[model samples]
Target: MDDIYIILVASLFSISCGLLGSFLILRRMAMVGDAISHAVLPGIVIAFLISGSRDSFEMIIGAALLGLITSFLIEFFHKKANLQTDAAIGVTFTWLFALGIILISVFAGQVDLDQECVLYGEIAYVPLDLWITDAGLNMGPKALYVSAFILAAVIIFLSFGYRYLHITTFDSAFAASIGISIGLWHYLLMGMVSMTTVAAFDSVGAILVVALFVVPAATSYLLTRKLKSMLLMTVLLSFLNSFLGYYLASTINGSISGAIASTSGVFFLLAFLFSPIDGIWIKAIKRNFDKSKNTSKTKFNKIFKE
Candidate 1:
């Protein structure tokens, strides 16, 4: 069904983004996904110009290259130019994003692209973009296949490079001391993020891609301390966001991508307030209980002395 296809594509995209996002959250580079998402606009335009087609593969290659460059520029600014990380990210993304807009405006007649559509995608259209075979067989939505491939690639990357990524993420100093190339792994991670962003761009748009990248991972991070547990929880939460968001959109007659993003935010708010590990409400309750216990102990001591 169309509903099932749309939800499936959303879930796959969420899982892929959430998995890589765990590492980004750990490294304090969560916004890097946001940067890459916007900064890749020029790459998409260039790819279109060069390939003379809006093919996904060319768009991905172009965007992935730009994403890597964005990562490098951010790091270069932070480490070499002594800019704060946030400032560096702000400068880099804005500059590149502006360039993309310029390119689109300059080639307005030839590009045949809409920046608004690219930034805020329409996920409900997934079922219509069917991947039909040459022989007239319906293989299903092309977005589904793209999302699945990205998820599979992310899983493979994490599985083999877990040790390096884990070490580099938590302790770059120790990893460097042990001869691990932090820069190499960082770029590789960014490359994957870029690919995921580009692949999901058509289906969910840049805005929702950033949500999928950060929200589920952040929610899981609050719920669990272990990286492995956080990743597993993120996958589960991604599915929940997709399913709930679909139904919510249908009920309200709203945009599916917006509903999914809103659902992710809701879940994140719940985790922020109620997570057992370090939730705001839970910590407040613990503090109050501790105070009461101390007060009771002091009262008992005074009575005993009397």
Candidate 2:
């Protein structure tokens, strides 16, 4: 029963992150997900300081706001200051993460937070934090509720705004020519990424959050070129990772989040080797076959001339 609840909570986290991650991967802004995951740390610390309570809505809101700020700063450096996108992302996330660490070090005894939990995560504790109603009804883990809501919200946004996102991602100039708000869609996607990043931080931590956001989506991206297929594959792969990873963690006596992240990587590796178009092994086999064909042609010409 304990493992069941953990897997269920993990499913919500994986699905929500995987859904938004597909778009991030599509726009080639996957690194931005990394930026937001790390940048939200300072906001979370500040929120805890001001609210004086670790468990409250304010902390999540604060973390989300910082995520948006991180996105904005990256854009500012990239567009206005002429810095490359990767450079901007690297600068923003490292600065914010360092500030968070300093705050944690100074206020170590004051707050209930620890850098270990912030970096590596303590998802095993998630099931211990249950949400019981006033009437004494068992409502399951609080993390499950938050993650499920975010997942539903992401699905709704993608469903209603698919056309706009599709156009903007593939061809921004065409979207602009048709008077579509490219910037609006861009920020909307970032907003979704920010919310999902903050939500997953508790369960997977900032470091492993990148795996949830990129690995499944990237594996799917390699499997198919169509957006719909990629989205479906991402969701399917997320579920697979969550279930299989849970058992793997139990067998190895390891961190559940870490095991899940590793499992996602394994899936990506399989796709990399077996995917029809861009797979490494597939290309190697094709090259060998082509070389054999060329050799046969050369031999046939020599024999005919003789």
Candidate 3:
């Protein structure tokens, strides 16, 4: 496919991932995104075995179902077995991913994938081998189109269900008491995360998928406290990083996914150091300013009293 189109699609995919990820971070379930991304390998492998190829629809369906299962397992262990949340996530994801790794190693000769491909996908090549139509005109790549629709779906869902999602993310118990099905919302959010991960795999690959999931949203969180604003900021940051990363990779003759991930890291670094609301530097500055203002107010009050 064309390089330009590939870049566009890749950026759109990142944007979609960032949208859902904003909520994940707000809900303090950021680690679950990481776990789901890793645990998806087994599902993809199983889907391939059943379908006998890397079919997009089938793979996504199978992968998303398995991702939900992984989340369910983590929840089960945490609630029922009383394990630490982190421990539950670690044990479950690692076990599943390890099984997938072993399966790949054993079936290396027969399988259509490789470790390198899984970790860092060829985003630059997605537009090259796209399905064409009778007109001979270049239709967009499937990954790009699929990601766009999914992103739109997520944005629409968040828009209409803003009230419910906001309440649930901030306080699930309260949301439930108020008539929201916290259970449905939780599953829906995680399901979207899984779907994004699977769609992103073909663009940035599996290991780096979390970059799309976490970094841009995190950077946005550092910049905004409001949910809708944060989601918008996340998408903007994600797309900017994607554009910069893709261009930089062209310059250095490097991997696109690595470039995008590194770009995201840079975004997080900037947000951490300079964001006006939650950044370390900004927080300190605000504190000092507040103290100076208070001192001034105290002197003025004493003068008035005198």
Candidate 4:
């Protein structure tokens, strides 16, 4: 039963990350997910310090706020300081992440978080944190509920704002020409990323959360060009990772989060190898076939001329 709950929780996190990650990948901002996930560490630490309690609401609010700040800082560095986008992201996230480590070490006795857990996560312990009602009703894991809510929010926002998201993603100038506020939509998207990252950070940690966000979406993108197909494929792949990773971890007595991340990477490798349109090996084979055909046509032409 505990294993089942853990898988369910992981599934929710995977689905939520996949849905939002599709947009991030399309916008060529896939690394922003990585940036935000790591940058939120300081926010989590600060929230813990202020509240002195690990309440979900406080943690989420703090992380989400910092996610927005991280986005703003990245933009500021890129535009104001003339730094490259990647450099800006690297600078901002590294600073916050370092700060978070310092805070954790300083408050080692008070805080329960560990550097190791932030890096890889202890998802096996997720099942232990059950959410019980005052009536003594078993309400499953709190992580499950939080992840499910974030998943629903992502679906609803994407469903309604599909046009805006699609336009802004492929053509920000066009979106602006049509009177869309690109900045507004961008920050809104970042907010979603922040909340999703914070929610999954507990179960998967900062490093692995980036995998869940980017890998499935990236694999799906390689497999298909259409947005709808990519989104559907991403969700399906997330579920596959969650279930298969859980079983694999159980069989090997390894880290569940690590196994799940590995599963996502495996799917990505398969897609990269076999995708019909853009796969590296497929392109190589096609080029070889074309060369052979051309060579045969040249030989036939010479023979006919002779």
Q: Give the alpha carbon lDDT tens digit for every residue of 152-253 in model 4.
A: 999999999999999999998998999999999999999999988888887899999999999999999999989999999999999999999999999999
In terms of lDDT, the best-performing candidate is 1
RMSD to true structure for each model, in Å: 1.8, 2.2, 2.5, 1.8
Reference-based lDDT, residue 38, model 1: 86
Ten-residue stretch with the least lDDT total in model 4: 49-58
Question: Residue by residue across 207-284, what tens digits does model 2's lDDT show?
Answer: 998899999999999999889999999999999999999899999999999999999999999999999987999999
Tens digit per residue, CA lDDT, model 1, 148-227: 99899999999999999999999899999999999899999999999898888777877788999999999999999999
By summed lDDT, which 10 consecutive residues of candidate 3 come out lowest?
124-133
After best superposition, candidate 2 residue 224: deviation in angstroms? 1.4
Across residues 1-306, which tens digit of lDDT does each residue of candidate 3 receive?
376786788788888888888888888988999999989988888787777776467888988998999999999999999999999999999999898888888877767878787878888877765657789876767666777877887788788878888899888889988889998889888888888888777678877888888899999988988877888898889889988998889999999889998999998999999988889998898999999999999999999977
Better of 3 and 4 by TM-score: 4
Q: Give the clash total for candidate 1.
A: 0
Better of 2 and 4 by TM-score: 4
Error of 3 at 133 (Å): 3.0
Sorted on lDDT, highest at the top, how do the candidates line up? 1, 4, 2, 3
Candidate 1 stretches with Cα past 4 Å from truth are: 298-306
